[model samples]
Target: MNEILTKERLIEARERISNQVKRTPILTSSSINKILNANIFFKCENFQKVGAFKFRGASNAVLSLNEKEMINGVATHSSGNHAAALALAAKMKNIPAYIVMPKTAPEIKKKAVAGYGAKIIFCEPTLKAREETLNNVIQETNAIFIHPYDNYDVIAGQSTAAQEIFAELNDLDFIIAPVGGGGLLSGTALSTKYFSPKTKIIGAEPKEADDAFKSFNDKKIYPSINPKTICDGLLTQLSEKTFKIITNTVDEILTAKEETIIEAMKLIWERMKIIIEPSSAVTLAIMIENQEKFLNKKIAIILSGGNVDLKNLPFK
Candidate 1:
């Protein structure tokens, strides 16, 4: 097939980073299945290295760079998991990583990034400010800018999660993942299409951050402005590359309300005894919202991450 990403690329990524990243487990909850009336599998990326699936992408991006590119190291702007993932990946490769984070970022996340030995530059929380700060860091260090979700290497790396899911369960009727900058969702779409052509790929998002949904329906990329959602990982808008992949491959974008997301998060904690972030809960919220459509079907949900700050939880 004529595609920007290929099965060979994803296979290469998995081989390259096999020793570097973890093949997180796939979990099934009988209670959850009974509640939704669908056979559901949860690809627990929360158990992934660096506590999120971002590690897979970061490891691939860092490892793909040659010695010359490694000299100056890599840099990116992120307030949460990506920063930590890139920093840890760079450390594993014995290279430097520069991360630009907003000063208002949660203390736990800031600490995690710094703990990985990345040099952190703080800026305002706005996109313009983050971009300006990241650009400045790049200029000063001459580091390669490894965008969190836009780069082909990163997408290929992220696809491995969905690839694993399909490998473990070939009969999934639908594979759902949360959409932020559309990295995970786009990667899932690509891998789902390649590995299990019969399975539909769905992108889930918080209603508060429904840029992907709007973009899907409008047939164009749309930006999220001042998104006020508990799912911090899904606040960013999609990149051009991700937008293209989502538009071409994703079957639909489902949005969940804030209450639904929180409730789903709580349910997972209560029943599955897993701590998933609000972004991960978006997938379950979408399924719960459209129960009848998925009833009795086999579905797989990508639990994107578990990096929520317990101190600032959405649920009481």
Candidate 2:
């Protein structure tokens, strides 16, 4: 297989976005560790700018553009996090950003994207509609299309989160990340391979939105159709580029039930006193569901984002 990214590329991406992206904290809950019989470290990307790790990739994509590419600005279609991240990244560069969002996206995310000064175009809640809408926006504005997860630079940028983890900790047996379009998971897999070869990279997802899990097992790309998961951030299917990287580097893909995801999310909120969206909780859900596999192991979980609608939480 052709190499889509290199260790140098990830290092470069970290340096490129270092000034813009936050080095989010690594948090651990002793009580939770005792309960699970594992040493779990949470790479709290929920505390990241735009409240998601998407900011790293978005910043890298926007900053990688040259003068000509920046002329028309950047454009993308996202259910939530990526839209807000790209909007803020473009705004920082004093350029315009056009975002195509599903009408069903959380109101908080819609407001966040608009607050970042991006022009939002609402479309049907389907990948086809999102792609068609984004294409039209790009044609009309001549903007560069920065895909949410398919681009190499975006994947490289996402790898920095795992790189950060390796910097602070060593000999971690496994690293888990929630897989949506596979951007963060692919990046984490690459980082694990380069920085700590002994570490295994696992991708976690909601069973309701298990396209990535299915694709990984089948070795084929599958569309995410009518997925009914509360992890809104993980509703999208993986792109060819991300799928290729994931199939090659990722060690395993695991799925969590919807109720288990909610339980894990609530557990983190109560134990760590930190807010995490359902998407982030999928990692913990998998650990909770497969306790034997991770027993006494050192693990790192990437809390993908905290961009949930407060009034519409899954909990009572």
Tell me the lDDT of candidate 2: 0.93
Question: What TM-score would candidate 2 get against the native?
Answer: 0.97
Clashes of each: 0, 0
lDDT against the true structure, each candidate: 0.91, 0.93
Off by over 4 Å in 2: none
lDDT of 1 by residue, 1-316 (tens): 3265888998898888889899999999999999999999999999998899999999999999999999999999998888999999999998999999989988888888989899999999888999999999999999999999999999989999998898789788999999999888888898988899999889999999888899999998888988999898998899999999989999999999999999999999999999999999999999989998898999999999998777777777
How much is the lDDT of residue 261 in candidate 1? 95
Best candidate according to TM-score: 1
Q: Every model's Cα RMSD, please?
A: 1.0, 1.3
TM-score of candidate 1 against the unseen true structure: 0.98
> What are the per-residue Cα lDDT tens digits for candidate 2 across 1-316?
2365888888899999999999999999999999899999999999999999999999999999999999999999986788899999999999999999889987777888999999999999877898899999998999999999999989988999999999999999999999999999999999999999999899999999999999999999999989999988898899999999999989999999999999999999999999999999999999999999999999999999887777788887
Residue 69 of model 1, lDDT score: 91
Off by over 4 Å in 1: none
